[model samples]
Target: MEDVGLNQGQVFLSQNVLITPKKGDTYKSSRLSALDLQRGLIMCLMAFSHCRDYVSSVPNKNLSWNSPLIEQNISSLDFLQKSLISLVAAGGFYMMMGIGIFLLWQSRIKDGVNPKTIRNYLVCRGFVLVTVQFTVLALFETIAEGQFYLYVGVLFSLGICMMMAAWVMYGVELLKTKSWFGFSKIEYWLPLSLGLIIILFSHGVIWSNHHYNISPDVLQIALLLGGEYHTPMFFIDINFTPFPWFPSVALGLIIGKIVTTKKEKAWAPLCALAFIFLTIWFVIRTANIQGLFFFGDYKTISPNSAPLTWQSYMSISKFPPSLTYFLWSWSINLLGIVWWFKLEQIQPKLFTSFKALKIFGQNALFFFIGHWFIYYGLSIALPYHLTTLTGIITVWLIGLIILLPLCKRWYQFKSQKNKNSLWRMF
Candidate 1:
């Protein structure tokens, strides 16, 4: 939603100061309401997970139930639930982005843009993402090995997703216009299912990276999720593969088109289907089926490693997501959508205090840069052992306390300006 940019000052100082095309206004959409909710939660989860992973004494850094964090407990079902929550939390953003691209693609066509030229230019965006990724790496990668900068993080993934979105939109137009797959409901569900299947395998590959070295895995995971940080760029991130993830954009387009333009009353059935799949996930994971009949070299390589059938079950190598990882995260996101529609009222009181939380969520990219920059600089200049679970919770709370009141007016202004719409996607 933001970059390492100038709004940094105005965003912090004023309550109702309008960010002039300064990225504060763009990408605000009702469609992203649920998506932003999902992104904010996942981004926080990412911060916590990374903090724990880098910090010692947390036991299970990735926030996985399989980790010692849960294993140490007598009955650690909570870890499992957390893992599931983490898994599904982040994927919605990509799915939403894909959907956005699809809509844009359609709109562009309607507005008389050449499809081929648009596709080529869109793919070029990947290079731009790679360019920015390397710039960040050069600026920040201080360590020799295992440095976070070796591979791209979140932004790179979206870049590739954007490129993929262009392609997928082309396919959507082709399929629907050609009737190759009958432009009915089947077209929507088919691509969605295919993307989910590819992501499952990609998830397995990504976990393998954590067990050993990630330099090789980085490319695979990057490609899987859309982009990675490998300079040579030969080894693609397979975990977040373009094959499936791109199609998800097409699928999202179809769904969005159906919902907004078609005005179809199809969500009730979709909600029912989501419940069915969710029930299955609960039953299987709860029964302790790690989805592996025999744990292979997973344990041998890294005791922390387990048979990863679900990508979201683990830390999910961020730059790119695996098949299982992408699906799991999106699955939870889908669940959120259903809940938002079906529940009508989900503890509105909970959402009230969440005003502060919602601000951090909305301005996540800025918040991430701010916190990480602060954390990294502070840790280097004046390192502290204040990152244990207690410290993290304290820091989390303290950070929110400091940021909330300071940033509340800006949020209030944004809320008032764009008061009626739920998601603020330009």
Candidate 2:
């Protein structure tokens, strides 16, 4: 991250390189306030989406293969709203994780940490996350729904992505050590290349599920390959898989390299890059390109019964995020980063109003775990009706208001704990 400060309507980047803040004024941060804000906002959106899941009478048709069409026709505005809602939750979170990992890697390198040590940490962290996902998160879901099922969700995907990133880093380092190859630039493009290859083949991988006669146990592997599968015995539900989503993290690695390498006028080039992504997204989405494997057919107001309305177009599949879906979600998220950068440069004090969001953002892992328990407990204890959109929104707001303080306190407690303690994994 760039060292940014605002002094006399001028923005100073790292090394005291000063340029006039865009539009003549901006705020600044010792840490990356923009990232905190983006992460905070993503958490809030996720809370809303999850709350809707738990409480709304209408099942998320997007999640069901045999869902019926919604009686109420969706308008363009409604489609846009739904798109934004979906984008922030998973898409934003994964991309930010990528960015965060890259930043952490840079910090570790600067602190003289050995590659082996860093790799160990990454591997340990990934295993811890996977363990938590299956045990803690699955337990919470089972409790909330009063069912016994192993749910492989976002955390599982994230854990896999982390491990993959670590290995990619290790490969780059290995290549760097080889005198004959002399492929120094491999470190920069390795993640991006791997990500693109995975994405390009993702559609074919998922589609192959139909042709294979694999056993149920072996079929469960689809959970990691961007396809949803379940076992009768375990009742395992692979809702969010790692295959398609890992690319976001890879792209984030590329972006992180850019941010670190281009300290001066970094935001300018980033903003331009964001525009390019947005343009590609628009073209792919509007044209309904077929080779991209966009789930326009599945993303209807109801599943398998669509004339392909605007809502259908906007509500792209998330279980296995399509190429268009990735383009759309990531482009918007990139633009958001640019927006936050500009906002930080202009109105630093304005961030004070979002103190609770910042706290939640900073302590995301804690909040992610804690919020589920809180929501599940409330669902069991309270007899509140939350069938309507207004009711769902109310509950979501209440969760935020209550969880904000809890998250802040938890963050403070974690800070007081030993930095080297295993509990730091939260």
Candidate 3:
């Protein structure tokens, strides 16, 4: 990670010659306040989205994120609002996770840690995430909904994907020592190339589900691939399946490499990539051919008009995030990264003044679990009639305010622990 206070005159002496890079060549660190602010905002948005569960006017028991937005008959504003939220919430989280993994791996290597120890720590951390998702977080959901089923959500997907990616990277590390073969090239491109393959194959998975009569017993794999499947014993619901969601993390790793490894500033190249992706997203969505997995037969919103225009055709699915969703979400997220990087450089005090976002980002894992407890507990304690949007907004704000002090305390406590402490897992 580049230090925020990095000196522009810092130079390396090569063969007794001091080489100083230009002022504009310096890049901000990935571990700086900018990244924290982004993470903080994502957590806040996630909490806002969850607040809808108990605070909204209408019941969302059957709301499927897998379904395309066009099918909902929402206005353009509604679609845009949901898209922006989804882009940052789930997608942003996974991408940040990837960046976190890369940074952790790099830090460990720099500190001369044993490879075995580093890999073991990551695997253990992954298990901790999996356990919390299934046990603690599941309990929270059960309490809120008054029902009990295994909670397979973004956290679970994150845990599984993290472990899988860790092992893959470990294997790549092992290959580096073999001079007889050209395995070094696999380190950087493997994750990204595999991610693309998995993403493309996901559309085929959707097609397969429609054309083929897959058996119910085997269909339980939907927890990995996505879509609904049932068994005689239990009902399984998946929000972010592992394979489909892996690309976000994989892309994060690629972006992390760019920001951290480059000798020059990352904003320009990142901005260019963002624009490129934005263009591709627009073209594909306008075509309405590929990049769309759940496009159902078009239907008229009213008796008098042709099937709803471009809005219906362009809207994308989320549950397993279609290619179009992937493109647009990441494009916007990339721009966000560049913006935050610039913000850190131009207005450091303004960036630091958002203390709530800082606390939330510093203790992200704690805030993630703690916020749910605050909101859901409050919902149960309060009157059931408080379902209006205004009511929810008030509740959400109060919940956040309540959480701020608690998150600060948690951050303080976590900071005192050793790097290897179990508390560090949070």
Candidate 4:
């Protein structure tokens, strides 16, 4: 939520001009409509993923749980759907966050906001996100699951990544002020450099724990660094870790900078870059080259389970996402951006026709919070599990239907000039 989209009272830019609207007012910026639509699409996919988790009877294990990947017990279609969602959903969200933050920063600069003031504001927002994750979200999950565990989830990770990005921005500013670096455009290289470093070193850092027998304190630190955590009483799994996700945010920042700075021509080069990355990803995955991390051969309990093929190659590690995972996921996101850009150009009305999805995109934080409660209530009242794809889609559509009005109402409330309550934090 920290980087989901515009804040409650923030005045965003439409093209290069600053539009100062009333507090909580929505700006009809067509340029950013594509982003909202993309976010909406991501939310739908996320709902489907959650539907599978709550409704499906199949036991879904982590793709990277064993030395070799385990062949999924699910049907081929289910496996494919889950695989794509697992790879792209979370990474896409983080990338969007990065893009959102950059846009926010650019808008603030256009409004003559001081750099320090902007940084402080972002820092506060980041802290609020982290707090909400541990408190509001944690409470919801505890109530739903009937268990009390400190779930450091996506919001927490996003908050931490925001703070990191803020520092990185500050560092870039400092470098620009100095003549020693001899580079005026350090911002262009910083995000990619930092992202590549994190991706390349993640596996080695995790491996060192096994060889050297890291202490509990050190292990806890490693867990924060995206290392696997498994304990009888407490587990800090990679899915919930923040470190591995930082790279996604970083990469997103790079794209965001390009979009905000380059304008219309950005998409062509970005699309080409994404295709190039996708090509490289295919080559590396097919050859089983360890550019960032090595994946083991897939093992299956049943002989009839899904075979190890290109699809299997596509099912890379996600918890601590490998380089290949980042490339594939971000490539899809970039291509989606290109596709949406073209669609928006050809038929803006057609692209914006899905009012419900655009609403969901605008009020993502509210929907995300509310949907969990909806799922929890449904799971309790229905007390039925659905195994087939049709059943899963049904449940997901039901969720969307249930959420649409709530999201719409909340969006209306949030858009009101007088409603400046803390509830707007969502």
Q: How close is candidate 1 to the true structure, as a TM-score?
A: 0.61
Best-first order by TM-score: 4, 3, 2, 1
Candidate order by lDDT, decreasing, is 4, 3, 2, 1
Clash pairs, candidate 4, are: none
Candidate 1 segments exceeding 4 Å error: 1-31, 53-86, 106-127, 143-149, 179-190, 193-258, 261-270, 282-327, 340-364, 378-383, 400-426
Best by lDDT: 4
lDDT (0 to 1) per candidate: 0.46, 0.64, 0.65, 0.68
Which segments of model 4 are wrong by more than 4 Å? 2-28, 58-61, 65-67, 70-72, 180-183, 207-238, 289-307, 417-424
Task: For candidate 1, write residues 1-426 as lDDT tens digits.
Answer: 221111122222234554444454222232334444545556566556444433323343243212321233322433553465445544565655554455555556666778786576566655455455556533554342334344445455556666665676566556666555664655466556656555555546544665565644444433543433355423322233444345345445555555445332445654655566556545434333343421211221234644434432343333343333444555666666555433324464554444454466566544554555444443444355563467655554544455555345545544444311222221
Give candidate 3's root-mean-square deviation (CA, Å).
7.1
Q: Write the per-residue lDDT of candidate 2 for residues 172-216, one digit (tens) a residue.
A: 767878896484567567987988787767655544443373333
Overall local distance difference test of candidate 4: 0.68
Look at candidate 3 and tell me the lDDT of residue 376: 76
**Candidate 3, overall lDDT?**
0.65
Deviation from native of the Cα of residue 374 in model 3, angstroms: 1.2
lDDT of 3 by residue, 1-426 (tens): 111111223332233344656665444332345566677877887787777665554332212433433444464434544666755567777777777677677667777877778778777877888888999988877776556655687778888778876776677667766785364556568778888787767666655554584542344355544554456544456677777778887887777677677634767888899999889877766555332423321111232433444655445666666677678778877787777777767887776577678568667778888888887777777767474567877988998999988877775675556667777677
